[model samples]
Target: MAAMLTQFEDLAADNTSGATELIQRILALCESGAMGNTYNEIREGLNLLEDAHSSMPSLHTVIQILKSEFLPGLKNADDLEQSLRYIVSLQKILEESGAQIAEKFLSVLERPTRILTISRSSTVISALKKAHKANKLSHLYVLEARPAYEGWRTVRDCSAAGISSTLMVDAAMGEAVQTAEAVVIGADSVSSDGYLLNKTGTLPLAICASEFGLPLYVLCDSLKFSPQTRRDVTIDEHPDSEVIEKEESDAFKVWNRYFEWVPINYVEAFITERGVFPPEELEALSTEETAADE
Candidate 1:
């Protein structure tokens, strides 16, 4: 963990210089369950993000709000570190909050579960490895999660390992689920109820899979488990301004965020390193689940 933090510190020292790369790297580490080093660096780097732009009121207000109301009165590096880690762990908390509840549910399931992997995400990779070791990885299906063409990563990775896989476009999930026993996906964040917050098109996929009588499974680590209330929680829309902005579209709101969320109801199961459970049971298992990450 300390080693991970050092790497994060190096990358996060400047938000604009390579913030996205650093974030990508940090996510890679966190997904691997060896993020001890990155945890601290990410926490420390929050200060850098808060200072990313000196002129943006929205950014400034968020930082100020974090300092004043959310994590007020922090004095030392350690306290600040803990606070920042907590903030970063918001996604983690949402992703994998169950312990007791999972233990209860998981105890009833047999090994060698069949899962149809739809999206390619670090979270998906993490789940694949864990389930593979635990004798649960049955099959992997690659959804051509597109626009950015990220699903290809999953297909490539799985194929390299000789894992049986089939590639489909973003639209074929509903049809594919007919043969699929279960639909498994990775999450960018797991809402308190285990609603899978992930890439923009994930929710529709989950919905389609659900309607097809397939169980929607979310494979996540507990760090993404958010304890916060889900009352209109804001999703950060990213700058698509760089994409079509140069294409002469409307100058305003041209950009979009990198992700979207599927509410918790469609989720049938959530598998985490700690355990697995129904989405509604997340908050009840904070015991075996420790809050540490970014």
Candidate 2:
């Protein structure tokens, strides 16, 4: 399963033949209980496919639709990365207008232009690094997304080059969101209507940011924007084996999902290389897309 998912991502990175079918297979693996070596793998696989498909915008539109509605469930991110490295090698090919959309979206985040900073990890943090120079990121409050704690890596990478950064419990996001000028978190997938499904705590944070009137920015490469829309984005749920031995708890009904949906209303803006827009803006974007097709 791990090997298969890796192949799928590689296909995605190249934007070559078999990518769509390969992606379908990868999703199947994720849902098939091959969770052990698939957790983090699917995210990478999806990212590559999303990025690659971005260049072929029309194709991406289709891919996004499929991904949003239903993504396979995988468990154990570490085990899933074997194939990730393969696709990582193909990054350059995957970026295109999709990457631009991602960058443009993130740039708009600096309202006062430069004050408080945002924190993120995984693909999003990587996307931010590409657009903002380390020094440019200097006062941003980049938090370490936890459990996976990939945010530590973001801090290290961003700070090493001079981006002032920090690490915090995923639980601390509320306080951070309340004080930060903008919450520029990354996105794993976006539903049409502009809802975001990302790391577990994202939904609540978006709400908190909304409650506090803070800007909640979703930084994603346009490619990361799955072809799928609202009804398309499906939550990937993992097995209880991840939490307990199944022997440990008498009532072990663990419903663990790697990502979640942040309703459009909760999202302040979407940061893609294309530039940021208010959540309502997605409605307009959708309309434009429809009109163009017509």
Candidate 3:
């Protein structure tokens, strides 16, 4: 149990893994009977994850399920077994959602098209690979997301999948946008005001894409949508050491914000497991969901 908790702690500290991947691992941990034997223990485990990755709405969804649906039912050994089965079912659902999102995303692409994207999203990568497989994707341009540099992982995955891709610095988004036919990105969360809360470079990428009249699509499942407004959302600031080796001094101060908001007007569409929709439609959907919950 101690070892399992330590492993989960390390996973929480990881900044590179996408939210989908992290949620899957969290479900696996719960199914392994390693989270804890009692409700408090499991709750603590979930709390650790929430604290570490507050920006991930999908992860918060998983945590909510475990807390509201599973934790309350964990009374006996038989109950624990039932909870594990529930976790397994949820994991399968998430997997299917990912595949569905990829399929929907592929349907929107023009044949032999080039795509430009920033940061690393498991869902976006899955869709790009699917498009490549279908012969609809000709080339991919990846922006090397700084701080965590997760774009390197995206390029590696693209290469392994035999997809033609180019890696460029985040600042080269203006140039990359001009070369690609469209922009596709992944969202950490879609804010209540219909803005995208994602990697720090996404706002600039969106600006470039919009200025060039290139369609910018956000690929994510509905689980990534948050009921919180932009002001309510927490934007994590990583260590200053990630930006510079030198400590803060009278000479300079390093600011290392990991995420930022991109205006909804910059996005042309949002491709999700359910279907593709425009920003206005998503805004209505978000409003409906919030009202229903209230």
Candidate 4:
């Protein structure tokens, strides 16, 4: 249990990984905990994870599944084995969902297309790789997500995959959008009101894409869809030192927020593992999912 808690703590402190990667790590931690710990200890570890990453609805969904469906049945070693199997199955499903979403997104693009994207999204990187393999990708424009500079990881991944990519500053989003054929990004969460919560620069990128009449695609799995509205979500503020080296003076204030909400009206479509959905259709989809859970 102590080892499991340490793993969860490490995951919580990780700001470099994308949402999909984080969810995958959460499942892995849960699987390890379920195998070695008692039901109560696993539950305690999960509670710690939940408190640490409360903003991630997808992570919460995985926790909810374990709590309501699997944990209750953990009465013996056999039950623990069954729970481990289920967790492994969930991990497999998540892995497949990324590929499925990539396929759907690639189908909508023209061959030899240039894509502009912000931040480091594992899902977007996978889709980009698939597109490159299929001869659909020409070039990629990656915005160097500020403060954390997560986009550097994306550029590195693209280079390793032999995909042509250019790294630009976040402020150059307008130029990037105008130069690219389309804008593709990943979402942290999609609210019931059809708003997208993602990396801080996403809103500006969407606006630029809209101004240039380019399609803005959000590539994510259905697990990112949240029952909460934008009002209910809290945007995380990072350390001020990330923005400036000096301490805050009385004259100036440094605001280092890492996430922001993008109005869905600017988006062309949401390409998910299930299918492509327009912004307007999201409300009904959220409603259906919420009803199913109830």
Candidate 5:
């Protein structure tokens, strides 16, 4: 557990990394014998990561959501081999879903054009790479996701990949949106109603996209879906040090929230493993299902 938690910390601390890679490392720990014999034991490991690490909701929520789909099938598996088999099965599902989600983006990126995205979503990065390989991506406009300045990492990555991209300040999202034909983002969680919880500043960018009559798309696997609504998730605020690196004068306070909820109305569609779906199309899959419902 200590070693696994350390891995999560190192991955989370890097502003450039995303939840997909984080989750993959966590699962690799499990595959290498970190997972215990019973389903509860495995879940306890995940719970510890959820409680202790500053990881994103999507990291834990993806497994939690998949638990509902796969755990019941494991009920009849009484031996360790059987238990591990189910674990391996779940891992395969996640990996394949990621590939399919990337493919969806490749299909959508039909021409060489500029796109605007903020923060760093592993899902978004993978898709962009695929689109670039197909020669469909001309440029990317990345916002300097403030405090952390994750956009610098995005620019670095795009440049390394031989894709043309520009980094702009957070406030320049409105300007970026004017030239971008569409806006794409990654989600930390998607409510049953299709609202998105992502890095701070995403909501305003979506609003800008809406006002400019541009479509905003979210790229994520189906595992990112959460039964919880926006009200159920606790949105955490980061330390003021991330915002102001000065004397501890109590003259003013800084509300540095790392994430915010973007209403479903602002989103045009979601690109999931299944395919691109309008917000309403996700309703059936996002609904909280009972054992019987499953």
Candidate 6:
């Protein structure tokens, strides 16, 4: 995930060579057959590239042409270069507007306010870092997103960047929410109905945020949008080993679900590269797509 974001960062200056090299690297990774999450990585890269090229109409036109010309007949994964180009082209339409979306989030922040968040997302982290740099962030409250403990990494990174943050057990989220000004999260996927599928524990945090009347902001690029609805999306069950050790086996079953669903109404707004959008707007967007698909 970090590597994919790094590739996007290389395109910060709108360098075509940088974008091409990133695509080449992505293709190489795809060919290596080691990418456990190729589709998401592609979306992330595409989101970044789209942001970099948002102001360049000629480049945007090139992206559209690439998608229109290459994507339709993509039959298999073996067509690696074609697939990469197709992804880049698809990004032009599907990726969010860009880092400007993150900038839009700064309006909701007040100086010296505590923001609650969970897990690690390149997009969410980048927004928080930006807020910190602007001196709008006073503190960050992170839940120790477990089975993987990705939140620990978030806390560590925040500390390294000189942002004061606290790491708490997942169970402490409700208590933390009481004092937090708002909650921010990253979506693994946003369903057709505008529901967010994110790391486990997000739903409860969202519920808590809603209960307290605190805003819950979802930071993500539009490429995270998936065609599936909540019921249609397959929830992956991770290995029990992720939650338990080999020596700690118990007769009781352990379910290690890596993600959870948070309904759209629980979110205050979606912070995207295009800008902040209400759930109604997302629903409208989805409705338009459904109509177009017919």
**Could you list the CA RMSD of all candidates, in the order they appear?**
8.6, 10.8, 2.2, 2.0, 4.0, 10.0
Please provide, for model 6 over 33-69, each residue's C-alpha lDDT reduced to its tens digit, 9 standing for 90 to 100: 2234345554555445555533222233334443445
Residue 212 in model 3: shift from native, Å?
1.0
Question: Whole-model lDDT for model 6 versus the true structure?
Answer: 0.68
The TM-scores of all predictions, comma-separated, are 0.59, 0.60, 0.93, 0.93, 0.83, 0.68
> Residue 254 in candidate 6 has what lDDT?
76
Candidate 1, RMSD to the unseen true structure? 8.6
**Model 1: which ten-residue window has the lowest total lDDT?**
14-23
lDDT of 2 by residue, 1-294 (tens): 567566765665431122223333444544442334444555566666665533233345544543443333123354345334333333433445445654565455443323222334344545556546523343556555534444566667666765555666667777776656666666555666556656667777777777888766665555455446656644545556654566644764766655566677777677655567777777676566668769
lDDT of 1 by residue, 201-283 (tens): 77787778778788776755554565543443466544564345455555565545445667888888777766667766776
Model 4 worst lDDT run, 10 consecutive residues: 244-253
* Regions more than 4 Å wrong, model 4: 38-41, 73-75, 248-251, 287-294
Deviation from native of the Cα of residue 108 in model 4, angstroms: 0.4
Model 3 agreement with the true structure over 30-53: per-residue lDDT tens digits: 766533664555667777887888
On TM-score, the stronger of 4 and 5 is 4
* Candidate structures ordered by lDDT, highest first: 4, 3, 5, 6, 1, 2
- The better candidate by lDDT, 3 or 6, is 3
TM-score of 6: 0.68
Candidate 1 ranges with C-alpha deviation above 4 Å: 1-24, 27-46, 49-114, 129-138, 231-233, 239-255, 286-294
TM-score for candidate 3, residues paired by index:
0.93
Flag the better candidate by lDDT, 5 or 6. 5
lDDT by residue (160-222, candidate 5, tens digit) is 998889899999999999988878888877876557888889989999999999888899887
Scored by lDDT, model 2 comes in at 0.53
lDDT of each: 0.55, 0.53, 0.84, 0.85, 0.75, 0.68
TM-score of candidate 1 to 2 decimals: 0.59
lDDT score of model 1? 0.55
